[model samples]
Target: MKMKCLYVAVAAAVLSLAACRSSKDAVSVNDLDGEWNVVEIQGQAVQAESQPFIGFDAQDGRVYGYTGCNRLMGALTLSKPNKIELGQMASTLMACPDMETERLMLNALASVKSLKCSGKTLVLYGADKEPVMLLQKRFEVVPLSSLKGDWRVVSLYGAALPEGMETVPALNFDVTANRVTGNSGCNRLSGAINHDGADENSISFGNVASTRMACPDMDTENQVLSALNSVRSYGLLDNGRLALMSEGGTIVLELERSK
Candidate 1:
């Protein structure tokens, strides 16, 4: 009986401590309320064009923001009033004109190990000795038509175009007719293309038809096949080449209209 009582008391104490810790970690939505302007971005002085910084807010302890380019959403657990664990973030697919600035912002936010506010300045220090970024409260305006179009590949891996293969082949696609007709780099192929057609994009190829050619470069052919299968985003460039990027914006293949 005594042992059982002792176990119950210990369990209760543990539960109370856990509850307290959870409450301590719970960040209120009001804490993140209001706009946050990028006072200093990537260690550069803010220019007139970069005046409007991003805005962030906490909704039920979840963090959401606009990084002057795309929508940013992530979770954060407040360990204390001045310290927190920045969770993984997912953003929209709008390609920023200044990709370097956006990348810097993302890297900075993702690397945030701890954060604190001094007067009106919010200081964010990244993980692993990364540089610090300072932000201030401000309002912002977002554009609607940021992402759109039929994109091509800026480049491709494996044999840029395969020489030969039977089942899988080197390939290229065309976006005008929503069609993909190419040498599977070894075999001849044809297919229908489908796309979301939004500035924030999502696209795919339909069933593909091909003339099975048996040559060589099986590895290149595999790469082509993989690229075709995994195409989720695309960027229409100034050049005729349609740069097809992956979900992570990594260029997987470039498809130019075959003349």
Candidate 2:
């Protein structure tokens, strides 16, 4: 009877040890999934009003986000607990006064070798196992369904109002009809948008058609049309701005929600 009790105790201890190990090794892609706003780089606080952000799309093994001034996309691979690898990244080349911060961010991303998450905070480590970047998970303020409203174009091809256009461009999405119509600053535009299989943060538009109205500002219209046609995905920024991106994850158009 004493031997039986000893055996029971040993079995219980073994089970307890296994449970502890499981808890310590528990890691999942969900831990890294979501939008994370840049808080610090190499222990220096990020001072930009438009803070950079990054997101991990576990479904497609893609990581994308804004780098203060330019949009960036890259490949991400996660191997269980605490093992992560970020592949070569591509970014847009929009000139901004805050290019210094963008450069710092891009450089840090290139050096990232692993990552650790504690609650809503994420820390990226470099080759020497030193923390290089700090980020906090960002929660969406508006639902993706809210994207069906009217939006006023704020920028096209990453630049402010094109040279001669005095009027602002606009885009309107009719979610129920799966159709979109708008003014491309110099022409009337309409198109079919497909959100059928899109997630809350991504969408694609069909071929957009515009009325051929010759205006002195055809330059702006052409830029707008090109941007709209190339849009392959969309994301809403923390400040309520809407970004339309191409397949390569470059921000082609930016807009603001209009009442």
Candidate 3:
């Protein structure tokens, strides 16, 4: 009778251990949602804090973010348990000194076959079941009041300004006055901006007027003016960059917070 009780106790212990292991391995799509910053690559720490990070939009099954040097977009699939698939990614081609890190990051993302999330930490595993990268939840949310500041134009229509432009375009958003004043390459522009609510995700420019000064090249000014007129919303990207989107949800301009 003692031997029989001992056997039953061992069986119960085994079942409890199995249940604990199963709970630890369980993962849901919700665990993979939200923005993540790459804190480590191949067991090495990533020192570039000003670089781009990754974000997952679970509602759309889309993943997008900056890859240190370029903007990347791809599909995310979580169809199977304990597995994930990152689809072929598309990115903007912008030359930068940190291209090596971007290349490795893109490769790691492409090779990811599984994922594990613990609290705010996320780990991606390759096909061989080895950790390829480690990411932490990015919690910095840009406030509406932070949008009122001076910004320098980084790109217009996805391209940098000419080498010998008379002056680089700049913008200054005044939250108090509900106005945006800036130099559109050749002309000084000022206009009222609409802040619908407390949500800082969307904004609109109303009736912008610019000085009639004509520079040697109106091409840049013309492009800037057109982009500004079509501006429908804006968002703060990583590294203190501002993205202005059009009515059709196209990014028309990217600006950096002026030092």
Candidate 4:
């Protein structure tokens, strides 16, 4: 009987150590510095046209956000890694067609006991240590400096690229030289980027010439070149995506961040 009791104690100790290890993996609360678009609740995507969002003020230790129907604000506190405590959250008493999402978000804030943060994503966990909410960084305005990196084409002209292609279109920005170099589906490309000079986000690609290698997807490469010429601005979207925009605010190409 004593041996069985010792085994039970050992098992409990192992479980406790596991929980502690999981908590240590959480990122510092200070990581949540910018406004983030609420993407999911309890693993379900939010389909409402009105996008819900949340922001944190590290210096002030305060929280503020919009619920797609009303505004919310509250005191925020963090005592240790993975743990977050939001004081009695107060929201504007506004009514809308549906308030289910709003209720779920507010409840999450109240019940969440832990959290995890990645480069631009944040997840909130409840007492059960299960993720209750997911959010991604949202950029209202993008700067030229913010886009200095490599990117790969995810979608072309609002449609997914065809599969089984020899090469996928991609671009690497050299901000110092004001040049972009990469593969344009069927050929190697080199180009110059011109800042609109009017604003930080307004940009245009110029003299984007490419190699003359004719491939099976030459048609796709031609379309890609046209899209680059028409790009007038850019925006950072959720999930680390960049959207090249046209004159009419249409997304001409969607690129994902690459190494």
lDDT of 4 at 244: 92
Model 2 TM-score on a 0 to 1 scale: 0.67
Worst 10-residue stretch by lDDT in candidate 4?
15-24
lDDT of each: 0.55, 0.77, 0.77, 0.79
Separate clash counts for every candidate: 15, 0, 0, 0
Tens-digit per-residue lDDT, 104-202, candidate 2: 998999999877776667888999999999998654434446778799998877677855457689999888888889998878999888763536556
lDDT by residue (144-239, candidate 1, tens digit) is 122223222224541254322233333444555677766645666678777774433456767866666665675665566677777766544445
Considering TM-score, which of the candidate structures 1 and 4 is the better prediction for this target? 4
User: Which 10-residue span in candidate 1 carries the lowest summed lDDT?
Assistant: 139-148
| Candidate 3 segments whose C-alpha is farther than 4 A from its true place | 1-55, 64-111, 116-123, 131-140, 194-200, 229-252, 256-259
- With candidate 3 superimposed using the best TM-score fit, by how many Å does residue 191's alpha carbon deviate from the native? 3.5
Pitting candidate 1 against candidate 3, the one with the higher TM-score is 3
Model 3: lDDT to the true structure: 0.77
TM-scores of all predicted structures: 0.41, 0.67, 0.53, 0.48
Model 1 score (lDDT):
0.55
**The candidate that achieves the highest TM-score relative to the unseen native structure:** 2
Which residue pairs come into collision in candidate 2?
none
Arranged by TM-score with the best first, the candidates are 2, 3, 4, 1
